[model samples]
Target: MELSQAEIEDLLSRAAKGQIVRTDFLDPAAASFTRDLLRNYPEVNYKVDGGYPSAERVRFAFFPIYVFPEDVELNIGFIEITGNFKFQTVTHRDFLGAIVGTGIKRDKVGDLILIPNGCQVVVDRDLVPYLIQQLDKVHRVSVKVKEIVREELLLPEAKTREIVAFVKSLRLDSVGASGFGISRSQMVKEIEGQKVRVNWKLQVKPSYEVAPGDVISLRGRGRVEVVEIAGVSKSGRNKVILRRYL
Candidate 1:
């Protein structure tokens, strides 16, 4: 859902009043918007965590401008859904559809890790019970759900393909198009359509310079990280190393 400036101000106002306001699961675009909004209100502190390592989408919690206790944990829960792995393998989209079908907002859900035998989903704590009760099927396959401890959560292993390419410039579009094997015009089109993200924030400008260590995500194309700038090529082009998530 699109949030207006007034709604953002109201959320900040509540946080300033010492109220702990937690938001639903926010996609990269919404999360970036919230981050930009929070920049104007330093008095209202907040945190964004997706409950696992390397989570792209996340939930935001607004806290008063005060030192937090050491024991304060993020309000995240894991739901382990197991099904007949031999008969049907549940994919990330399948689990996501089942969760969303239960009337849960997209922002309330986090990463969905597909395991060999089942899948694990990170979600807001408030919706744990509801998800467990409602997430009984994934597509046409029957599934079982139960809450698991944070330690029990299984994270997906990263599988990336290293790409070494030379581009005219280190701009997002230049490196992304060359690394992903797309035309420059196609990359620009994707950027203009708001289907490209740099470091998890929506970046519309194709000319935005991308630095080493920056991760670029294109909708429908997976993600790619600029690993390093090896050096300048003989022709004065940039020699860059990229790791594309597979």
Candidate 2:
């Protein structure tokens, strides 16, 4: 991820002045970048907050060494969208499209978890009222949007498909194409076009090596996790086990 000069500098300036600094929702790349960059300033302390475990989007709260990390407020909110499913069912794209249509920037929103009979939406707390009033329908389906506590969140089980494949090298393109079930040529195009991400950071290099536990995701497609790398096969190809999120 390309680090923005103003973004990091502004946060650092606040911390240097002993002022509590909080950022808006940040993508995984920005979060990772800030998490690493702040380490240079040992006087400042920070907390990575995404409202839930394994959240991709998160905010960082920076304060002085004297301040309690838990005292910093992330101001995250959880909202649920439920609708009559017999007539029409909604998808992630549909939910996102409807939310984006409400004139809210994508950065203000976070992850949308799919659940039975509805979906759980994590977002900036200040935007809750606006969203609840403005967002009422997705495509042709009528939805009910309401605020919910963290414990009330009905988390759904993640779906995955395992792939066991062999390749000469564990290059991004080779593993990505195999996991995404696409051709190497097509994967290259997507990578160069900035449609691919490794661990939620933009990765344009197809030759980038991927180790076990690295996540490879393609825009419009689900994510893939490199689960294992056993010894090379008899044919000399590298053996791999990948779990592709469905």
Candidate 3:
């Protein structure tokens, strides 16, 4: 629901249990809607999420809004999403990027970004109908209500080098294939063409198995799967290390 800062504050104050998820996205009418909600309802458990778009995923890439009852746990969920709306983190960099991409110039004030991951929302079940009504008039945001499950960490105790090295050892063509959906050859070409770097240094080899303490940087695919070679290979053809980007 759109809400003014004052109205939001008032609503929050009146809520016996309250939560708000801010995004970097903004609608001119959002603040006013928020104010209206506060004026009408003293207790509002509003859960909002938002984020920027990524080439990696399409659905939750747009500015998205969602709500669940306040009893739900706020945990980071990692799932392949498919829908009309996408999400990303709301940061100064994200805001400027949106402005540049959309060619929409507006000031950033109390704007929040709803990352596709790393965020959640909670609201009272009874308030959903009213929330949906307010969202109908708010532009640039599409709201969906879903049961979310948080992502389970694979190696919580593993270090960066361990992660990268483990991925490299996956015997995939490239780090992209292992961590991302891209192929190994594609990753190699990007690096060999001076598009890839290890610890920020130009790297051209796709088969260059990552080790612990190495930071592999790809131009378009993003950086990953290189760390210091923390351990040696048993057959001498493989090694183990942690990835800087897990």
Candidate 4:
């Protein structure tokens, strides 16, 4: 992947401020051009995707480069992400599913990006600089996207008692409001009926651990994403923050 001196300098200047910015160009072809100009900078981070899903793929590569050290005190880092304009409605799931599975269906390189995990939906040739940016010790350039199938969703199974469990911890009704998008009573009833899953496994206990990668599917309601495990409450219960998608 190659970037122009101006684009490279722009990314470096922003990285100095600890801001993660996806390049505004939004062109995959620009990534190749940018990669050619990035050879002089060693402190910057970058990735490229070569083996994409389609032929009309804009001849673009997905590039995500992070400029934060692992041992840094802050949790955030600067990321310069670039991609070509493809289609919309492309969710983060589409990106991760492509990288970890049999690749995205039919659609060619849509330049998708999945957050939380920060995995890039990329083509085959653009994988080099990306690996260089993420790995610290070695400079192995050849890496392939391997597939691992999960017959069923796993982790982050929702339970009927989770509303009460979160309520018990924070003494707040927001969990009921934010999670189920319904009344607390409705949440209690739904959970008790064994309608949730934590990490793709059916979770019956309301107090089950809502770890990352868990998807909670409510029959009437929509899915909720357990984005992260923030921290423990003063009451000693697990504090799992979730984002429900309606």
- Candidate structures ordered by TM-score, highest first: 1, 2, 3, 4
Model 1 weakest 10-residue run by lDDT? 65-74
Q: Report the alpha-carbon TM-score of model 2 versus the true structure.
A: 0.76
Best candidate (score: lDDT): 2
Tens-digit per-residue lDDT, 96-145, candidate 3: 34323333333222222244432232222233343333332112333343
User: What TM-score quantifies how close candidate 3 is to the native fold?
Assistant: 0.29
RMSD of each: 2.9, 3.7, 15.9, 18.0
Per-model TM-score, in order, reads 0.82, 0.76, 0.29, 0.28
Question: Which regions of candidate 4 are displaced past 4 Å?
Answer: 1-178, 233-239
Q: Pick the candidate with the highest TM-score.
A: 1
RMSD in angstroms between candidate 2 and the native structure over all alpha carbons: 3.7
lDDT of each: 0.83, 0.86, 0.39, 0.42
Candidate 2: clashing residue pairs, number: 0
Worst 10 residues of 3 by lDDT: 55-64
Candidate 2: list runs displaced more than 4 Å: 1-5, 93-105, 129-143, 164-166, 182-194, 228-239
lDDT of prediction 2 = 0.86
Q: Ten-residue segment with the worst summed lDDT in candidate 4?
A: 71-80
Alpha-carbon shift of residue 41 in model 4 (angstroms)? 43
